[model samples]
Target: MNFLLHCCPVHHVMVLLFTTMVAMEFGQGCTQITTCVPGQPMINCSVVTHDSNSDPPIQITSYVLENIPPNSVIYCLNDSAFFDTPGTVTYAASSDFTINDAINAVLLIRSPNREADDQITGRVTAFDTPDQSEANLQVIIIDVNEFPPEFIAPDVLQHSLRFTEGERPTNSLVGRIQTSDVDIEDSESTVSFRIKGNGGDEFNVTRMTVGPISFSNLLYTYDSPLDRERIAFYQLTIVAVDSISPVMTSNPSLQVNITIDDINDNAPQFMGDHMFFIPEGLEEGVFVGNVSASDPDAGENATITYSIASSTFDREFTIDSTSGILRTSSFYKDLRFADNMRRLTVEVMAEDNGVVPLNNRSVFTVVVQRPVRFTNNIYMFELVENNNPLVTVGNVSASSPDLVSFYYHIESPGSDKFTIDRNTGKITVQESLDRETSPMEMFIIAAVYSNHSDLSSTAIVRIIVIDVNDNSP
Candidate 1:
């Protein structure tokens, strides 16, 4: 005869019952035998779960059985479960198959010496029945490998590194990448480091092993020279990867920032050669022109100042320390030459405000020309007292060695009666002149360059008015 078992759930408790019975027997009174008999007890259980290397024992409900006669008992066939290693799985209970007055069992799973088995099986039996029934109990130990790699030393996550440009050589240690894994039992997991993102090509990482420990160091490869003027700061990502079947990288990444400090490696250079023109006799402190320079460095290394390093004339010019504007000094009035044309060569220096102070020099050529001069110092003329207005008095002339045009004007007293042509230098009487009221009219004539009023010369002229009277007595 065949017997069938069925499982039922009641209030979080699982109960297994033998539904079909084969034969029956009576013990009291007459000896009677029937086709029906007591069925064997049945046991049913769920798989118990636990972590491979964790603290605290796992607790699960004990198996419940039905179809058992009176005075029957339930117990485990063996004390431990069978797996790759013995004694890894064990169970604890109070009295009989109850724990803390409840039908719960405590399962203890020790830390595995090596890779642990996925599951372990044990046998549970119900005795004292017509025929004993056995069932299998399973315990699954899950491998705990959940932590990702992390950077510890130098703490790239909190701080950055700084280096002076051209100070360090290739293969120099930039920083050490110290890392650890909380799942220390997982000896199979190995961590490797690498560089990523911009400026990563200029650096490299190397892993080294000392004894049973391994670590990585970030190095300055110098594949491309560092220039603070070209690029001042660089940001690179440091990634730590573990050698698991499915690799795991560091979360949020380790950002390694590097700042290149500036040095006075570049010299101040003039923007271009400067040339200027200034007429003679200009007052001191006249602005000539600007002389500019620039530096590509940062901070004080780029601050530039200008100065007159050398000049053909002493104390002839001055320059601004910060603005680089060139100005004339005391020698401005004495710049004229006998040939009426003179050039001054000035050497200007542009220096940066560094500790060592790098500098550059440039030459500036300034042309100074003499003022216009009159041909005669004085001129005498006579005019009739009753001469008509707009009559020609006399002609005065001046010349410039530079061949520039001239402008003429009267500068002395009694100049209102006479007018001079600015371009032609011709003097004329604007109104009739009287010898009785003003016998002699003395005035000064001034000539200046058309473009440069500062370059000028002066001359004297005397006009005598003859008396011619027509008496109307």
Candidate 2:
């Protein structure tokens, strides 16, 4: 009977060892723990073991893994002695992971996100028939530089800004740029900004903190003066980059378009000499002269209009507002009747078309002149015969209303007997004369003319020789 008992215990031990070997070969069983040998009877046990292919804790980088299949195994759990006795092993985990009942494995149902936390702690429970085992399934999510800096404020990706030329002061804030990064905090903190393009020389960027939360902002400021006449438009690109090694820049960079507006900063200026001359007795609508002005501004600021501001002969002259042509008005008359030489002072104004108009004034001197004429047409002069040479005789005088000097000459025959002064109309005897040789009453014609005019006057002069009778018969 004792031999029988020993044989029966050996058989039971062999059967238990066979079941454990089969469960281990299949790799879908509990932990194989030998409590007895060939001479001892087996004790029923429930044990859970980790598969060689799976580790207790799983590790991966955030945002690196994508599209993991449902029920994807991250960890495997097995019972070593399930073949010897009827026992089932079930697996469970925290919210970060799920259990696959068919394979008794832990699955990565939810991906690890470093944004939530760097480390995730989850309990993986393995439940056997009568006992359960719990293991910490720690998921270490590594941080990675994934996304580049992105612009958020200045909500529109592209911007257009306008300012009047010379209106904005240097270092004035023109715009604000705000950016965000979806990466980890360290990456977001390392974001910086810069400007690129041909127009960058006129602008600058500065970092600033705003709001109670100290939000980061990039301020776009004017660095140089803007002139609409010089440069009217500017194009720039705004780029954002992180300070991390192998820096990442923003994709599809932001654009900044700047436009310069015009202002009436330049006043109209008169051009050329402002002196003019016109003759008297000019008909109405006679073109006197033209006055012109120029401005170095654009658009309406440069448009010019002309007018006669003040004049000595105000009602006698008229000026075209658009063409700047000055003309005689209906009130114009012969100025020579009033004054032989008349000079008029005219004040001309040139104004620009602007919101607040600007103007310039200039003075023009206009002179009026008349034809030269004499005051007398006839004169009488008396001289005695047998007078000594160079003897003075009566003078024949003439004048011009134009205030011009005259030259006189004798135009009649027998004039050589007497000489006349060119500057003054004084008659003098050239030689002694007797009454028989020359006529008793001599009539001579004298002419007076001016170098300034072709018009002249003639006068008749009679010289009656006295009968001195100094002739030898």
Candidate 3:
């Protein structure tokens, strides 16, 4: 902040001057202080000391001065002047230094100049009052971080250009980001100045000489902010060498990422061989020729999605989402189909789903399916006991490419009491059959099938009955 003096310093001193003094208070051994101007009846001040027994109020009861004679006069007020239970006394700073509740003598403060400095000497006289003493207590006010730079505009990153001592004109708000640490503006601690990245005119950092600068500035403004892009990118090497033991520092720089964009303005052209003939009479779901195009734009705009140009395929075919392969979704008759011509020319196109900068289009020609067969094959199956029945058998490695469904049925000798699963082909016996009646069981066909009602397959099982009991032994 700039200031205008109301009057000259020499003239201001002539206005008026005054003097003041301190005194011990009243009440038993306790002391109080009162102020008095220069000629205003110089009330002779006196000091005294006493403990709790004396009533008046005093907590700490002892203190030591430069006890040596000619320097100070010490005395202990004989009475007992103790403070409250908390042993506290009002208007009292700390109870640590005192002589038996003794107070100090009154002190006189002198006025000053633009710069204020003063020296004082005194006798303890009484421990009751420190106001008369030379040892002093001072309070310091801290500063905050809020000052706006004296230079209205902080240096912005020079993204558009590079910096060279003589390359461009001087005073060019050279690549600099200005900021401040001195807060509590309007105070002496707050010193604002226009900031220029090159260490500013105030001082240039030849070797990081600290101490001289306000500790506030040095301790706080350690890191300088930078606009990476505008200045293109900066490789600032900051080496912090501390004087303290185990001093260490890091001289690090950074490589910023910057991507330049391209202009879209160009129309997408076609890619790959253009000509290909497909057999006539194409049907839905046919794969044919693939076509694609690309953009010169960056990011999403550069990525190309496909579609059959509407101008060409008002309603023609579909294109693969990823492969760009084109295919017919509907049947189309050959323009020459009237003369047994089964081929028709239809266009398929691709379109992009670019969120921005509009969509790009491409087209392709495809062949459709005519007539094709997809025969079914049998999967291997295994036989298993139904557990509910004496035995069960399931499909096990058997099949045929026939239209007929697998008509699984029991062909065992006890067919009336046996059945098999149509799908799993697990054959099971319904009743407990006595194999002894027919000691040698043969031709127990457990399954039958016909893929096309014309195709068939079968399997049989034979069991050898054994007698466990002997009659004549």
- Which one is best on TM-score? 1
Cα RMSD, model 3: 19.7
Q: For each candidate in the order shown, give its overall lDDT on alpha carbons.
A: 0.63, 0.61, 0.33
Question: Which lDDT tens digits does candidate 1 get at residues 1-473?
Answer: 11121122322112123232112211122122112121223232322333334222222223322222322223222222223232323333322232111211323223221133444445434233233333444433223345677667556434577888867744577776777755434322367777787778777777767788766778877755677876788799877777653467787678888899999999998886477767767778898879999999999999998888999875889988999998889877675675534778889999999999999999988877667888998988888888899999899989987777779998877578889988898899999878778888889999987665667899999888898774455
Q: Which ten residues in a row have the lowest lDDT in candidate 3?
A: 4-13
Which segments of candidate 1 are over 4 A away from where they belong? Answer: 1-147, 153-158, 169-171, 181-198, 224-226, 243-247, 338-341, 369-473
lDDT computed for candidate 3: 0.33
Candidate scoring better on lDDT of 2 and 3 = 2
Stretches of candidate 2 exceeding 4 Å from the true structure: 1-146, 156-158, 162-171, 184-189, 196-199, 216-235, 258-265, 272-283, 286-290, 295-303, 311-316, 328-346, 353-356, 364-473
Which stretch of 10 consecutive residues in model 2 shows the poorest summed lDDT?
A: 1-10
User: Ranking under TM-score, best-scoring first?
Assistant: 1, 2, 3
The digit string of per-residue lDDT tens for model 3 on 214-320 reads: 31111113133222222323333222232212222222211112222333433445677654444444577666566666654445545666655552335445667
The global Cα lDDT (0 to 1) of model 2 is: 0.61
lDDT of 1 at 429: 93
